[model samples]
Target: MILVTGGTGLVGAHLLYRLASEDREIRAIYRTHSSLHKVLEVFTYYTTTEKAEHLFKKIEWLEADIIDIPQLFLVFPKITEVYHCAALVSFSPRDYRKLRKVNIEGTANVVNLCIDFKVKKLCFVSSIATLGKPISDKKMITEQLNWNPETNHSDYAITKYGAEMEVWRASQEGIKTLIVNPGIIIGPGFWNKASGQLFTRIHHGLNYHFPKVTGFVGVNDVIDAMLKLMNSDNFNDRYILVSENSSFKDVMKYTANSLEKPEPKKDLQKWMIATGWIFQKIGSIFGFKRSITKSDINGLFATSYYDNSKIKSAINFNFTPIEDVIEETGHLFLKDNAK
Candidate 1:
């Protein structure tokens, strides 16, 4: 049997849908009862409501948190393959501690159990944020680039990098492992979370677009890459899974066209970003969520690119174009909102 963490998340949900449809004996861990809805919602995105209900019943849903070692251990008896996707994603400074505890420490615990259980293979989901930033000579970040400690980094990036360390350590301890550094994953489900936030914010009429360029991939492609890597003899390897490097302006324009909303016409100026961060800092004093920060502003304006040729070469896979990904996800968002 296979055990999957974060099985209710955007990527995890899609992974489970694929695994279950393939008639694999799968067990998925979740922290809350409400998260189950997201799993079913994702299945419904690909199939009929009745078929989704049937697929949902096929999964062995277990209530467990990655941080809770005792609870996590109970579900590992017969598990052979492990997919570690559970992580806390937060950009706010206030969430720094929680992100570290859950992302870094929790991943360490998962690594410990994988070793203890003698699991056959472990597939880890890491972010492109863990990759090094390009400098003078280097134009694109790849698996070969080493992270520079002197550079400015987000707390989320810091935690994910730490998590990658745990996975690398596990590989050293003789656990066959595969790590995927995915870009911004655009998909349909849980519209308020992660990349789905882009759809929600755009639908609600966001008017400003950042000029930053970054990597992007659809949710299905990420899952497909993970499975392909796990099934193959490729072990102790890391691949950058990105479909394309695109600017936020084009992404927002495509999104606006798909949603039938007014495209964001205003380019965010440096002064406006500075003022916004200033207000966010002031609001943080009153316990307001800090949506934007100095690190975010810098990242938003930087033109970072990723080299995805490694994964494509390894898996012999082609990624879905960003336009189609945006359009499909946009339709799903509209359909969900209409209900």
Candidate 2:
């Protein structure tokens, strides 16, 4: 039996659809009843309504939180394989404690349960944000790069790196583990959060585009790589699952064109970002919500590249082009909004 955490999330929902289509005996955990709608919506993206409903019924849904050890303990029984995908993604400084609790402590709870249950295999979904900055000699961040604690990291990155440490400890204790650090994952659904918000912001005529470059991959590629790695003999190793390194300007332009929306015209100069961060910081003192942070300024302007050769060589894998990924996701975005 397989157990999946965060099964209602963008990656988990899509993964559940694939696993159900293959007729796998799967159990998934969700925090809320409303989130189940997301899973069905994702299934219908690839199949008929009846088929999607049927596939949705195949999952043994359980309400659990990873941070609650007793609740998480009940989830691990009879689960031979596990997919750890539940995570709190936040960049706000106010969420630092929450991020640490959920991403780091919550992952620790999951790892403990996996050990207690003697699970056969574990797959963890991590982000490239945990990867260290590329050094002067090495232009691309790879699995070989060691994290430097001295370097400033966002609260979200810090917790995820800590989570990776727990997963590494699990491998030492005899659990076969596979960790995948994916770049900005692009997919349809959940427009209010994460990468899905990129489509929303672009469609609503975002006027500024930053020049920072980072790795990107379609959601399907992420799922494909995870499934292949878990089913294979690969374990106790990490893979970077990036398809291409692209600038936000190009990505936004492509998304705009796909959505038939006005392309962002401003270059979003660093000075402008700095000025906005200053005002946002000042506004925070007066109890106003902060939409921008100090770390966000650096992230928006930094040009960091990721190397994918390791995963490609490890699995003989090929990635879908980002342009095609944006085109398809944009089509779906338009279709959903048309309703």
Candidate 3:
């Protein structure tokens, strides 16, 4: 039997659809009943409502939180393989503690459970955020980059790096583990969260595009790589799953064209970001939630590229182009919101 955490998230939802179509006996944990609707919504993107609902029903739904060990323990029994996708993604300084608790402590609990259950293999969904900055003379960040603690990092990144440590420990303790550090994942559904919000913001006529460049991969590619790696002979290794390194300006322009929305004409200059960060910090003092942080400001203007050669060589895989991904996803976004 297979157990999946964060089965209702963007990656997990899409993964569940694929696993269900293959008729795999799967158990998935959910924090809320409402989130399960997200899985069905994601399934409908590739199939009719009836078929989607049928596939959704195949998953054994268990309500559990990765941080709650006792509750988490009950779901691990009889689970031979595990997919650890549950994580808290936040950039706000106020959320530092929460991020550590969920991303770090929560992952620790999952790792411990995987050990106790003697799971055959564990696949962890990690972000490129945990990866260190590219070394000198290297243009692309790769699996070989060693994280430097002295460098400033977001709370989310630090905790995820810590989580990777736990997974590495698991690997040493005899559990075959596969860790995938994916770039910004682009997909349809859950328009209000994560990279999905990029489509939403674009459709709503966002007027400013930043100059930073980063790695991006379609959600399909991420899930494909994960499944292949888990079934392959590879274990105790991490793969970077990025399709292309693109600038935010180009990505926004492509998405705008796909959505038939007005492309942003204004470039968000670094000075503007710096000014906003100042006000955001002050606002936080007055009890306003910070929408921006110093680390975020740095990320906003810094151009970072990721290398996908490792994963490509590992799986003999090909990635769908970002332009194609945006076109299809934009079509779906319009269709879903047409009502």
Candidate 4:
């Protein structure tokens, strides 16, 4: 039997679909009732509604939070493979505590449970943000670079790095582990969260574009690489799962073209970023969700790139072009929203 945490999330939902399609007996953990609907929603993206419903029925859904150790342990019986995908991604300073609680402490609990249960293999989904900053302007970040403490890292990054440490410790305790540092995952479901927000902003006619370059991968590609790695001989190692290094301007333009929206004509200057953060900070006091923050602003202007050669070499994989991903995802986004 397989146990997958965060089965309702972007990655976890897709993972569940693949596992269940293979007729694997799997238990998926979710924290809320609404998330069950989300898993079904994600499955429909890849298959017909009828087939998706069939695959969805195969999963044994369990309500559990990774941070709650006692609740987590209740679902671990008869589990051999573990996939830890629950995480909190936030750039706001106000979310610092929640970020640590979910990404760091939650992951610690998962690692402890994996060790205690003597799980055969643990696959952890982490972000590239946990990696160190670029050493030079022209060099792409690889698995070899050491994290520099002097750099200005976001609280989210710090917490993910801490979570990676916990996974590494679990590996030391004799668990066969694999970690994947995925780039921005663009997909069909949960358009309100993370990379899906890019599609939403584009559809709503966003008029500002940043000049930063970062790595991006399709959601399916991420899940594909993850499953391949877990089933392969790859163990106790981390792989960077990036399809391409694209600029925000190009990404937004492609997204706009796909959604048939107007592309952003003006570039966001550094001062504009600073002022926007100030206004967002003020909006937070009135209970408005802040979109951009100081750390996000920094990320917006940074030209961080990643080399995905390691994962490619490991699995002999080829990634879908970002343009193709954006076009397909945009169509799906429109379809889902039209209802």
Candidate 5:
């Protein structure tokens, strides 16, 4: 049997569906009141048993927290494999406590469980944010490029790096662990409400324009790569699972073009950043949920890029084109608008 953390998240839910469809016995861990949502609202989490019943049937849900070692150990009796996809994904600083608990403590708990249970394989789903410790070195980052997140600008970077460290430490202790660092994942079921909100905004022309430079990947391709790891006999190591890297302007224009919508007017991002920062400060003072943070605004607008050859060489797989991915998802979001 397989155990999955963050199984109800955007990437996790899609992974769960694929595993169930392949006839694999699976179990997932979740916490309703946990702090993971403090950052991104954990868009895919279900509030009721009835809501969760809407998905695949063969899977089991364990109401456990990643920081709770005793609860984690209780579920490891017959579990042979694990996919640690749970983490606090956010750009806002409001969720520091929850993010640390989930990302740092949660990962440590998984490592301990793996050692105790002698699990066959543990695939950790880390983020690219952890790859750049003291800011990114190259024009793009890959799996081998290791850096510390301590010097990074945001708390999200710090916590994610801490979580990934546990996996790396476990690898040295004979845990047979592998890490997959994915770019922005987009596909059919964007369970993350933030992603869903982005889609909704784009469809309604609320977020009219965007900056240039970003990374993107399709849900199918990400699933394909991860499933390959899940079934590999000796693929016990680290890999950066980034797909085609593109800029925000490029993605935005392509999405608009694909959906038969008018292209947005190009505007100076400096002014927007200044405005966003001002609002962010005000929101914090007023105890309001600031939609975006200054660090996120800076990161998005930064002229950043990454290399994908390491992943291609390791997996010998082809990535879906950015246009195709955008076109496919864009058309679907358009369809949603029609409804």
Candidate 6:
């Protein structure tokens, strides 16, 4: 049986759709109250009634948290392969501990099960953040990049790095493990006020500003790479699963234009990074939602250019441009706006 965690997430949902079509004996784990619930919430938000009903029923879901080792084993008894995707991808400072508990310890727990169950291959869906930052050589990031948590700007980064470490440690124990560090995932789904901010704001015409950030790949492309990894013809070592490094401005403009909306009037200036930090500090002191935190503000300016040639060349895979992902996202949001 194929055991999966975070099955309700965007990547998870997309993976589930693919797995269901193949008639794979799939098992899914979820936190009773998880961000994936909002993934489903977005279905009704963006999809037609017929589409929502059709997609929802096809996914065979099992409710369990990655942290609950006993419960996880119950759903995934004698698993053949495993996919670890559950994580707290939040950047909030206040919830940093919660993020660690789920992203780090929870991942460690899954790795342990791999050892106990003698799973054949374990796939950990790590993030590009674990690589810390782009190197000065301007080459595509490869498996050579040892995960460095020191450069991490957010708790999510640290946790993903730690979880990856767990997988590396488990690999030492005879569990054939592979790590795929996917960049930002953009695809079909609802935002539900959490991720909703990105979809809603951009669709409602608030995405006029862009950050000088980097790293983007499509949900379809990322998933395709994962399936390729499962087939064992790609790189024998860890791979950087990225498409291209583009600025946030390009993504925003492309999105707006694709949705037939007016382009944003302003892209984020370098000065706004500092301004955002100040505003977040003040908001934190006043017990308000700091829309921009120090870590987030720093990350906006931190990303350097990236080259995803290693995995692309190894798998002989050509990536879809960020524009394609952005345009499709725009269309999906516009359709799901619950107009």
TM-score of each: 0.95, 0.95, 0.95, 0.95, 0.83, 0.85
Quick one: RMSD of model 6? 4.0
Off by over 4 Å in 4: 277-294
- Candidate 2 lDDT tens digits, 1-339: 999999999899999999999999999999999999989999999999999999999999999999888888888889999999889887778888999999999999988888989999999999998887766623989998888999888888899999999999999989999999999999998787777877887787677777778999999999999999999999999999999999988998889998999988887766765666434322222122456566677777788889999989988899999999999999999999999
TM-score attained by model 3: 0.95
* Superposed Cα deviation of residue 73, candidate 5 (Å): 2.6
227 in model 2: Cα distance from truth in Å? 0.3
Higher-scoring candidate on TM-score, 3 or 5? 3
Clashes of 4: 0
Give per-residue CA lDDT, model 1, range 1-339, as digits (tens).
999999988889999999999999999999999879878989998899999999889999889999999999898999899999999887788899999999999999999999999998999999998998777523988999888889988898999999999999999998999999999999999777777877887798777777888899999999999999999989998999999999989999999999999999988777765666434322222122645676666766788889999988887989999899999999999999999
lDDT, candidate 6, residue 55? Answer: 62
TM-score of 5: 0.83
lDDT of 6 by residue, 1-339 (tens): 888788777777777666755767787776665655554654554456566566656555677788887787777576888877777776667777988899889988898888888888888898877774446635555556665556646666777888888998888998888888877766767454233345555566553464555677888798788888877743225777767787767766776786787767765555655656334322222122545555666555554555577777767888898788777777777765646
Q: Mark the regions of model 2 whose C-alpha exceeds 4 Å error after superposition.
A: 277-292
Candidate 5 worst ten-residue window by lDDT = 38-47
Candidate 3: the clashing residue pairs are: none
Which ten residues in a row are the worst by lDDT in model 1? 279-288
RMSD of 2: 3.1
lDDT of 1: 0.87
Please give, for residues 192-235, the per-residue lDDT of candidate 4 as tens digits: 78778778867876777778888999989998998899889999
Count backbone overlaps in model 5. 4
* CA-only RMSD, every prediction: 2.8, 3.1, 3.0, 2.6, 5.3, 4.0
- Which residue pairs of candidate 6 clash? 42-190, 46-336, 191-196
